[model samples]
Target: MGKYAQLVIGPAGCGKSTYCNHLYEHCQAIKRSVHVVNLDPAAEAFQYPVSLDIRDLVCLEDVMEELGLGPNGGLLYCMEYLEDNLHEWLGEELEGYGDEDYLVFDCPGQIELYNHLSVFRSFVDFLKNDGWSVCVVYCLDAHFVTDVAKFMAGALQALAAMVKLELPHVNILTKVDLMEDKNHLDEFLFPDPELLLHQLAASTGPRFRQLNRAMGGLLEEFSLVSFLPLDITDEDSIADILGQIDMAIQYGEDAEPRIRDELEDGGDDDDDDGGGDGGDDI
Candidate 1:
């Protein structure tokens, strides 16, 4: 048996932390256990229970002061430092977790880490070697995907993470409730490439419209990525998103046996109490 985890990742202000927070709360509401690990060393606050914190190993402020690096540079350094110490520090941190435990690793908002960087890849490989099943949950802000160009860009970003991570990937369009016209998101959520191209032609200049056509064609040709809207405010929406993730990671299969065991044990106790305890009391 292996531990299951979702690496919650996205750009800054895309609601990665908020997604983790909501997922944590939803799990609690349903009486399911899901633990969160804050992988962002720069995180200063937490809204959910943290099982493991990267800040304990490396703090961005401390790194910046010691190395005299700027914010991004300091963050990159901290991630690399954490990567270097994965075997020693992370191994011990994960020791407390067991099979059937579901972990949500709330990652930093470094686009480089998700693509064009080996740090996160190496870390993910380490987790795999340690018998953990992992999935990548890539988030994009709903407000950012309003236009055709932005939709193409967001899709490509998701595709990039998929290509780089090489894990089970789930893309989420988050903060849907914050969108100016929530009803208008349907077109982007389940996009029509033809419609997108037409919109692109109308919106942008001629030179860029050609580029948009080329990129849009590439996206249509690949047809590998899509986004699920996440309001987070709606329980059904959260459950639907979680269902997709659970299916991708085969979580239901792992849970069935545990549920059966508990039910059987409960039945045995009920039978014992009714027959033996009742007669003894009489």
Candidate 2:
């Protein structure tokens, strides 16, 4: 049996780690056992407790020292190495867990991993083959909501990942707490198709109008893109987000129902025949 897992993915500085940390706390409050696995070989520090760490297998500093590769190159190399040894590295890391365990993987922020590369897909397949039900959590920065063109671009990138992974997914807009003027957030939250197209065309340069139109049409046609706002500071928001993901993975549905076995209506297993009944016995 394999474990249940979620891959938290997004571009750099989009608060993937922050989201993971917040999720860790949220799970704790709800009394749900969740383990976080750090998959970024170059991660410097993290706020959450890591159950399984890839740095044990490959660290960027060690790769750079031995192979003289730069940071980006080293990261790619580390991922490639993991891919080459998926069964060995990831298998060993996941040794102790039963099939019912839940894990949240804090993946690297490199967009290329999900965009055109097969590393992430391969990893997902490995987990599935091992019997895990996996979900992809793709995050975008809510700060980009103010810019129509940028939002379109980010949405398309997320869409591309959704199509490529072809798994259960949840799109999140992170850092909502940082927004000063959240009134404008509603426009981006539930976007109007035609209005979004017009705004995209106006904000972008002339060169991008055609691309923007195509993207806008795709989003409107399939209704494939929507984001749940995530404010790391708000516990309620975190709980809501976690609840959505939990539903996606179908967690806790397989447990046996609790049954009441106690006798009712003042029934007793033992009655002493009216307090010993010595006269009747004689």
- The candidate that achieves the highest lDDT relative to the unseen native structure: 1
In candidate 2, what are the lDDT values of residues 93-169, reduced to their tens digit?
77788767899999998888898889998999999888888889999999889888788888889889999998899
* Every model's TM-score: 0.89, 0.88
Looking at candidate 2, the ten consecutive residues that score lowest on lDDT are 258-267
Off by over 4 Å in 2: 256-282
For model 1, the local distance difference test gives 0.88
Q: How many backbone clashes does candidate 1 have?
A: 0
- Candidate 1, residue 128: CA error in Å? 1.2
* Candidate 1 wrong stretches, greater than 4 Å: 255-282
Give candidates' CA RMSD values in order. Answer: 5.2, 6.4
CA lDDT, candidate 2, residue 239: 84
In the range 1-282, model 1's lDDT, one tens digit per residue, is 458999999898899999999999999999989999999989999999889999999999999999999999999999999889999999999999988799999999989888887899999999999998888999998887677777778888888889888999999999997877776787787677787889888888888876887878877887777889998779998899999998888886866898999987787688687775653465
Residue 89 in model 1: shift from native, Å?
A: 1.1
How many Å off is the CA of 36 in candidate 2? 0.4
